[model samples]
Target: MSNLAIPKNKRVIGQRELVALTAFMMSLQALAIDAMLPALDEMARELGVAEGNQRQLVVAVFLLSSGVGALLPGSFADRFGRRSVAMFCITSYALLSLVIALIHDFTLLLVIRALQGVLSAGLMVLPATIIRDRYEGDQMARLLSLVGAVFIVVPVLAPSLGQAVLTFAGWRWIFVVLAAMAGMAGFWAWKRLPETLDPLDRQMIELPVVMRNMTHALLNRSAIGYVLGTSLLIGAVFGYVNSSQQLIGEHFGMGTWFPIVFGGTAAMMVLSNLVNSRIVERFGARRVSHTGVLAFIAVSALQVLAAFRHDGDIVYFLPLMATNLALLGFLGANFGSIAMQPFAHIAGAASSIQSFFRTFGAAVVGLFIGQSYDGTARPFAIALLICSVLALLLVLYSEKGRLFRRLNAPAKPETKPGGVY
Candidate 1:
């Protein structure tokens, strides 16, 4: 099983199994992030968090730790094996979730949550590296799109699940459920997932080497642009996730019905993922992503207009929010794939650095924007607009002013002197 060579004729993984595993792995992040939303107020009250904004620190702390985790896990996965690292990470995360559930104090809870993020980063980075190891070009995009389609459903259901747990048990029970889910996921990976990294390709994990590689990724124009572009897009998403429960429950007078509304909007993202999958083979990732970015800008602009015009009515709010989020599914997968296109040799390191910047950077930006919750959707909409603009600009720059170019362009074989990627 360790050295099972995937034949070109036989599929790397059965489509159904690949979708199932990817969905499960990807859901780790969504469940961790989204399920906490409904419980934020309750947790804050329970812990006596001083500022309403401080509750957001719980989420921010997790993402910040994810950034730290993202940088190093890639090298470990490359050196060891994807399956081993993934199982270890998930087991750690599940244990941390249990710790979070048991914690009574706010500071301790934050520390536990951050550790959970660090552990969860293995799930996030290893899957993409495995996908790359298995597939490339259109096939890779299709696989990612399939995973994206499934991943969207997690967020759709998470808040609803959180609300249900809140109703029957308590907020602590939500973390209990998360711990159970993480344990199950880790067990599945250990039992079913095959190692994809080749021992010959493994590199010595060194601090200087990791730092040098990271600096190369950050300084590379295309990599930098893709990182920033994805970060901004993620920032918008984080802002929404942070505020959705409050807006729907408190402002829109939805209460328990909040998850239904939230889930409904989230379903639209599935539609977007389906659309991306359909067109990615024909039109390619860059074209599809560019169109998505433009659409996001338009949707955000309209939301801003409607907010100013009607003072944030739910009638105008829901549709705009749905459209904005739907567009995110389009940006999420393609940007990472495209960014890593040039860094195949050190895919693990590149993945780690890119994931760190995108997730943690987005968390920082989103936390800042989310703190300005004025009992309206205006701030969220405005943040989306700004992120969209920045993302669009960076995408243009990343593609060397050719935003619509197909991602399948033949690689230039010339090596850059001393470049780590």
Candidate 2:
């Protein structure tokens, strides 16, 4: 059914190209964050950050600002077009990376990172909005999962890349590499990415119109519940990323192998997302994600138990943590697709608003979890369990207490006649 619904002759790019491009564009966010993980300690020392937990601000501040910045690009995209806004954001991101590479002051670096995050957030928001311009419902979930499978490659390799840079060229050059990558991505987008916003569906950029559209998207019962739920899940993941270097490298005595260990855990998500893309259409996004959430809670419970043992045994901790993180592959794309179901007409504004909540919520929760790190995994474990359980409740609320039932009335695209859906 989803296969038959493909928007034929509408895309300037092929399906495979679209998926790969969107995934690479999305991967930029991951690369920006993850590539800095291995270098955080070095960055801390150079920037005069004496406290250990403060280093997390480098990542956390960017995430927080990205969330806040997510609100603008969508409305602009809705007014102008996705391609123009995306191009502007990508170029700004590269330029900011260049600036950060030259900065010496810790506060100055963080300020630029925050600003960069705001500008670059469109890189995260626009891809999903573009996908929504082309597809929705379970088919959208499948495509997003495919995107996730590819995006996970960055997390798998970014830490190692950071480590290699740190080994040879020092931490500041990490930003130089980021600038180069962003330039490449921006160039690809310029050459190949199409304007996905149909003229008929475009909204005015006036404050009132933007607010109304944003309010409508947020007020939708099904959408907000899933939005909040997914936020918590991703928040927990960000928390892990925040403290992962210290946890794996310093506390576990795996200093040199941190990238390999971190990347190995991230690799699990690649497999899970691949499986999700394959099965999501058959089982439905709700059932697959619901099952995944339940399994997540179970694994999270064991993680809490493992952390409580105070054994500090990497052998037991690594696999359990990896499994728990992998479950996000099942939840993220499905939850996002479901939340965007009723907003086909205002995909840009809706995507931006939802992205704001998701990213902002995750950033706050993750910052707390990251700062709560006590040279042990207990804080992380407890936070994951709490997030998973709350997520289940939110999912239940979204479905009116139902768990595994599929959504029968899938949303129809509101595109005009002869326009891309």
Predicted model with the maximum TM-score? 2
What TM-score, computed on C-alpha atoms, does each candidate reach?
Answer: 0.84, 0.86
Q: Model 1: residues >4 Å from true position, as ranges?
A: 1-12, 36-60, 99-109, 163-176, 245-257, 372-380, 407-421
Residue 84 error, candidate 2, Å: 1.1
Any idea how many clashes model 2 has?
Answer: 1
Candidate 2 lDDT by residue in tens digits, 240-352: 98899898898788999987898789888898998999999899999999999999999999999988885478987899988987898999999999998887678888899
How well is each residue in 57-173 modelled by candidate 1, as lDDT tens digits? Answer: 887778677778888788787667677788888888788888888899998898788878877787778777777666655556666887889887887778788999999987999
Candidate 1 overall lDDT versus native: 0.77
Q: Candidate 2's error at 158, in angstroms?
A: 2.1
